[model samples]
Target: MTQSPLHILEHTFGYREFRGPQAAIIDALVTGKDALVLMPTGGGKSLCYQIPALARPGVGVVVSPLIALMQDQVDALRALGVRAGFLNSSLSPEAVRDTERALWAGELDLLYVAPERLIQDRTLELLHQCDIALFAIDEAHCVAQWGHDFRADYLRLNVLHQAFPQVPRIALTATADVRTRQEIIERLALEQAEQFIAGFDRPNIQYRITQKNNPRRQLLQFLREEHSANAGIVYCLSRRKVEDTAAWLCEQGFNALPYHAGLSPQLRQHNQSRFLRDEGIVMVATIAFGMGIDKPDVRFVAHLDLPKSIEAYYQETGRAGRDGEPATALLLYGLEDVVKLRQMLGQSEGSEEHKRQEQQRLNAMLGLCEITSCRRQTLLRYFGDNLAEPCGNCDACLHPAETWDATEAVQMALSCVYRTGQRFGANHVIDVLRGSEAEKVLQFNHHKVSTYGIGKNLSAGEWRSVFRQLMARGYLDVDPEGYGSLRLNPSCRALLRGETAVHLRKDAKLAAPEAPRRSPARDIDPVDLPLWNALRACRKRLAETQGVPPYVIFHDATLREMVARRPVTEAQLLEVTGVGDSKLARFGEEFLAVLRAEDYEGAI
Candidate 1:
């Protein structure tokens, strides 16, 4: 007897129901129709195709860019008793031949391949010999030439449609705006596919953005206060910063590692493996590090520098709290981040139109950082989703920002920039306004300017806030010549001439850091702590024996459920979420033994 999709969900994957549009998507693919799915990171997008592959008649071919993570993905599926395999550079020739044999013999329900490999003439020819169920193009946004994380190899994926016109294809991504969506549809030849745009909201993850003030110290304080013993990722803008930050964090007694394109492949793989397998390890990396990470319990994602666009920021931060538990996304940015990012963008070799689009994206990202209203509302609106009311989870909603009339302050700052030849950066211009007799101010003889010392009522930090907001609001522009000079934009003319009133978000004074609100073991009761540790130990042992990540056996969420319910028998253990038949047959006895021992010890 064949199992229905719902039956497979319950008996194999251990879920009772599908999430969002997952059921509809599976129905489409199982009926031999194509689909285009835009779901969030933790939205169970994989299930949309995986279920159809099991319910339908042939092997599902997944085109993935994460060659390094393909083995982990396959390991995870196999843990759930799904016949999954992959062909990537990580495999030996013998292993590749073995996997190919499995595919030809109809032993695999799913086969994962890199786009580069799948587009090869040899791979395409080999696929033509087998029965293909459906093609899933993961990370579908990479097909967009103007999008972040573009890959040349993805452009050739159109061949899948041309070669296998009768086979259904599903393209999926976690991030894409209207333009990129159109690009994916066109590039992949998915014009006839049904579009499923799920809501792009991660309410469990709190959003926090703050101005950079001695950012390293700020990061340390954040770690000590909120995520002291949790796993997280810290993002930097450069490889050197990644290395430096990782070293500094280790000095501060954190188990932090650096990951960048500059690291040797062996070391990078080792570091990534440890981060996935160990508890309370932090990975500090550049943008190149996290395109396809599937870790679910990341407690936080911190940015010491600004991201290039809201889309990039969304994609990176979405890695946290993927298990639907509470997570935090913290960002600390300053005017210097904006300057550095703009300089990099200006130096890019992209066409003029591409450069302009990127500049607009950067400006929008700055607007998100500087907004006094609800950050989540503004963030979702950027992606074409609207929240009916303010999301009380973001920093702005939690601590409402105060604004003040800064008309005079704006006039003083812009006039100072104009009077100082508009060639210096924010610091020098701010010095001229705040009555600083610093050496540079004296060297340039800027004291004679009429705007000099006109804004002495505000402190240096306050002036910096004004200038940062000025740049964020488009009243000031960074020079395009790669210099850090500040120039007055045409938009600032009305403000400088006192024709417009400027209301700026008042900077909050540094307060004593709050105590960690959520514990590493948030849901487990104190009495169950020992049992939780024992269960985790059991899972770790099993993972080590299998040579896979611990989460592949069971997510933290599933473990927490076990701790809460204390299932001691086969029936009770099977009732726990994520306890499918294959997992029960494989490791249920070990977990039950642990639970029974704890109960017996408690009775004593």
Candidate 2:
């Protein structure tokens, strides 16, 4: 007999209730219906499909793009006492055949296969002989050609519907704008799928964006103050930067490692393994590092350079604080970062419309950085999601940015761009405005211009801030063909002519580095610290024996609960949020023993 979704969710997954639209999505899938789900990270998206897979008869064939994480994903399920296995290149031929036989014998509840492997004719033929419950396409946004992370194999996923017309199919993703959503529907032939948008807000993450000034030092201070000894990701725009940041962080006594496409495959895999298996390993990487990572307790994600778009930013930062704990997303960006991104965009071999869309996305990212209001509000508005009130956690809400009437400064900066023949970048324009006698200023005879000495009151840094704000607010445009020169937008005519006033956000002064005021981990009482360490040690030992990451055993939240509630019996242990029947049976007594020994003084 088949179990109900709620029964599976509680007995198998140890959750009493569904979060957000999980129950509805699961019901639709269990009843042989299609679905397209857009849920944020840590929003329990997996349960929407996993529960249905278990509740329904036959094996759930999950088509995922994360080939590297297939083992971990299946391991997590197997830990839940669900019969789960995966078929990918990582498995040996013998192992693959074993998994296939298990599926044939109806011994597996779920089977994960990468898109590249699933598209194989032999794999499809083998699946045709098996009892299939449903098909789930993970990371559905990869189907969008213009998205930040596009996989060609995702384009061929429409075959799932054509081949398995009688089987229910669901597409799931954590990040998608309206355009990307439509693209997924079209590309995956999911027009008939019921859409479930769980909104794009990650309230547990604190958004903190600041202007770049000695970014290495700034990142150092941030790590020292808030995230010292916690696992996090530090993103850089280039491989060289990733290497340098990783090395510098290591020199500063951090357990940092570099990961980029430039690294050898073996080395990259080694570093990634260390990051997942070891505690407090900071992986300094380029954009290539974050997709498919299932680590839930990443306390922070810092960016030494600006991402190209808000979508990319949201997706990357969402990796942090996935366990629903307080986490930080710190981005330190500068005008040069913007220029570099635009230059790369301009050189792309995309259609004019595609480039235009990309530019708009970049502009939106810049707007998020410069907005003086709540960062979460502006970020959510971009995704067509609305927060009724300000999120009181972002840097903007905690310490509001000061705004100043910069109408005169903006007008002067615009005038300087115009007087410099519109062929100069912000540095040249600012130099001209501040009456600099640099050779470039004299070489172009810019000193003779009327605007050269008119803005001597503001410092050069101040003028750069003004120009950056102007660009961010759409008053100024960058000419990529002209080598990133500054040009005034026609909309700026009103401000230049004094018909409109401009108010720009003043950059906050960098504060001195200090230790974190509070702990990034759960707020356990000092008396409970010993038990907390004991539970963590037990979890680590089990994880090592099982050859999985520590988090795969149990999250820190779960351990904290074990410490607080002190569950002594099997029934009491099952009451913990993450403690399901499988976990309780497999490791319940081990944990109960630790809890019973309240005076256990083992150090972590």
Candidate 3:
């Protein structure tokens, strides 16, 4: 008799139960059905297909986007005693031939291949010859043309359904808004596939966004205060910024590295390998760095510049705290960031409709930044997920923002813009409003206007914040044709006429929290610290010896559990969440030795 999926999951993967829709997805695929799964990062999406691959008769072909991702997945699967291999450029010719031979002989349960390779005629013919159980398309959002991670290779994936109509197919993505979701379904021809939309909230991550003021200094402060000893990723918008920030962080005595497409392939791979293998390394990178990374203990993701869209922001920040431990997502934005981003969008090559859509998306991102309510609620609502109440984890909830009636301030700002002829940008308009005697204010003779000096009580930063909120709330618009000149929208007429009241978060008091002196790992007991360190040391040593990522050896969560529970025997160890039979046989003795030593020490 054949073993059940639950048996394979418990014995091979070491989990006693399935998470979210894993069991349902696996059962559907195993029984020959298609699915489109939208799960958050660290949500156990891999198991949705992996279990089906093991239970089904033939090979489960995974369409992966990156070579590193394929290699990591194969390594983890092999560690679980699963028959898995990959066919990608990273593999040597002999190894490719061997993998191909194994697939033909029905010896492999799962075969991971890049989309570019999978779409090839030669590869298609070979796969057609094999009895395929299913085609699992990882990162399916890449097929969306408007998506941040779009790939032309993904456009060819429709061939999978065309050629193997009888085989089940499962497409999975961690981030996709409603539009992108529809695009994935239409593009991949998955109209008949069951759609499983999981909750988008990653509750473990605490979200915070501060207005950018001396971004480098602010980033350093955030690092020194909150995440000095933890692994994190700092994202910059440009390659130059990435390099400079990484170098600067290194000078500050952090293990920092730069990763961008401009770097040589060898250097990129080296930096990525270092980030994956080492603990407490900060990878300062452009958007090119993340996507397929499987590192689990990244404690935070900091954004030094504004992201292009909420989708981009979500996907990038989602890289952190994949182990379900508490993590931080910090973003710093300023008016200049909005101007630069809008300018870039204006100059970018695209159809008029595309540009309009991009602008709308940017506007949505700006709204998220300026929201006075719970950040998590605002974020989830963008993806069509509603939180019943405030998340109480985000900065807005932890330290609620104070809103003030900005009707008068907004009226003054808009009047100033109008009186200044709406031909000048924010700085000039702000100068006129705040009664500045700067040359431009005098050059334009703006100091002579009645609205001039009306905003003298508000500081430049406060005025800037008010203006940003006005633009975000649609009472004001940035005139791209006029070099970012502030223009009053028709809606401002109501406020300017006292017909409407505007409220805004008081920007002056919205300072970031001071760094706490205590460690984030305070949940661990004092008595368990030594044992925790011992477990980590043993795991790190094993990772070094095996030459795989440490998380692949065992997640930090698993180590913490071992320290807390102090399992004494093999049977007790198997009760741990991540302890599968394969890991128990391979690493059980080493961990047990450390635990037993700690136990003996305590007894003595």
Candidate 4:
């Protein structure tokens, strides 16, 4: 059997060899078999369609969702000497016309179009005239109503095959659950297409969700630890928060910028460009900042507010560590996030069915936050995937979560809430528990309550944990209808009767309680910014080259080591922390070249 030179060429211009589903996906497309690729965020997904598009006869049609992605992908492809162009709202009419002319003239290798534009009759008519190789639906999960960035325009993608039935179509998405995958299949009318699910586990990402007590300070700590690398995305719930957080981050002397729907398109583009091209810019944005985005070196993804679902969480966290080096997803939440989220949920304008599905999604996100077991396990389970053991990469696994029989403490707490007339949230109730003689305690006469001064031994943080855990464990519920008052749940009866043990797990801190003091300015990697960047370019090129996902070769840790060590030989590579024998032998040559050919040395 003759190997198609696409496999060989894949290594040449692209970088690495194909691994796992990549070759099969390329083969499926090369053979004109329509396919759906359900790959994780950093899963070498772009190559599945891109390589085959370049390998086979004519221009590959890639239907992308975001304007930023189209620009960046085209730029990257052009850098590697592959002809690429995009037709989206961002392009002028003349640009779109010239791109269409190029498509008809067969001057471009890959053509990316927004789904809305792809659906237009004029575009379809022009596409029909071209010797189209394949139709690649990027971000295919947007077809589902259950998706975080649902695009009604994606529903039109199904008609593509009907118009150009002979052309093979490959639908792809970075994050899609079984439901969303199925929806993409049905909607695209590709039921017979081969389904390729690259591994969902992002082993390099350290997944963590911290309680949102003083999120600003907590965010500062994460930046301190991870900012030695490119500062990562900090996602907030609202446009206001995005602006506020971005401003605050800048004040702290980080090159942070804001991006949200509310921003002028020019500003959003400017912020995105700064993040994409420059190093160490923390783009504080809403979820709008990252879909279909191809930024491989985002060191961390911090959530300043609650994410709505497991899919949304997976997609957002998935953005970090895409380069397969160790990145972090630091999510900060409080009990009030649920209330605030549910309030937002309750206000959404949609069919009742949509609302119900959204509620289920939010509930799943809340469960992930509340789960005491391995967080990665819960996250995988939510996507209808399974993991055998604790990930050992998340907060729960890093520090084994502590659980105490809170049956008595919960009983006292719930009974106290009930006695206090069930009108107060956790803070006020905790005030009563610790016998705070503050004005509210004295005015409401909570100081005289039976629970007052009974738990003075518990620290303020510990008491907050008790309340959060109580709410999570279902002994209490936050009544969104009642200004977030703590209401006694039916489980409280069993706890109050001492028949059931109310297990309360302590909320883990942002950093270890005993960790050393950190310098605010020390967060920036003034030491080796130039070196780390070259290693990052290595990761990105290697990811693009071998059809094998970037993370599989060497994690960000290994790359950082190569940069920090300036490893020039295989032996030196072995000495790097994350570069084991197999990885060193495999990627040693590529990485050495990356280090030797360095402009970033002066950047340091």
TM-scores, all models, native as reference: 0.97, 0.97, 0.95, 0.83
Q: Where is the poorest 10-residue window by lDDT in model 1? A: 509-518
lDDT (Cα, 0-100) at 210 in candidate 4: 76
True-vs-predicted CA distance for residue 515, candidate 1, Å: 7.8
Q: Which residues of candidate 3, in runs, are more than 4 Å off?
A: 508-521, 598-604
Candidate 2's residue-wise lDDT over 1-604, tens digit each?
Answer: 9999988988998888989899899999998999999999999988888888888889999988777778888888889899999988888999989998998899999999989999999899989999899999999999999899999999999999899999999999989999999999999888999999988999989888999888887888888877778999999989998998899999999999999989887898789988999998999999999887989989899998999999999999999989988888999988888777877888889999999999899999999999989999999999899999999888888888898999988889998899999998899888888889999999999999999889999987788788777877778877878889978899999988899988888888654322252353448888877888888889999999999898888888888888778888999999998899999989898888888884676433
Question: Model 3 Cα displacement at 369 (Å)?
Answer: 1.2
- Give the number of the best model, judged by lDDT: 1
Q: Which of candidates 2 and 3 reaches a greater lDDT?
A: 2
Residue runs of model 2 more than 4 Å from their true location after superposition? 510-522, 602-604
Report the lDDT tens digits of candidate 1 across residue range 343-447: 788788999999999999999999999998999999999989999999988889888789999998888888888999989988898888888899999999998
Estimate the overall C-alpha local distance difference test score of candidate 1: 0.90
Worst 10 residues of 3 by lDDT: 509-518
Off by over 4 Å in 4: 1-5, 8-12, 347-353, 435-460, 512-604
Q: Quantify all predictions' global Cα lDDT against the true fold.
A: 0.90, 0.88, 0.87, 0.76
Candidate 4 per-residue lDDT over residues 108-186, each given as its tens digit: 8899899899999999999888898889988888898667888999988888879989999998887777777888888
Sort the candidates on TM-score, descending order.
1, 2, 3, 4
lDDT of 3 by residue, 1-604 (tens): 4468999889888889998888888888888999999999989998899888888889999998888667777888888888999999988999999999999999999999999899889899999889898899999999999778999999989998899899999999999998999999999999999999999999989899878778888888888877888889999999999999998999999999999999998899999989998988999999998997889888899998999999999999999889888888999988888877877887888999889888888989998998878999999998999999999888888877788998888889999989999888888888888888999888878878999888999989888888877877777777777898878889888888999888888763335553442343656777777777778788888888888888888887888888778898999999998889999998899889988893534432
Per-candidate clash tally: 0, 1, 0, 9
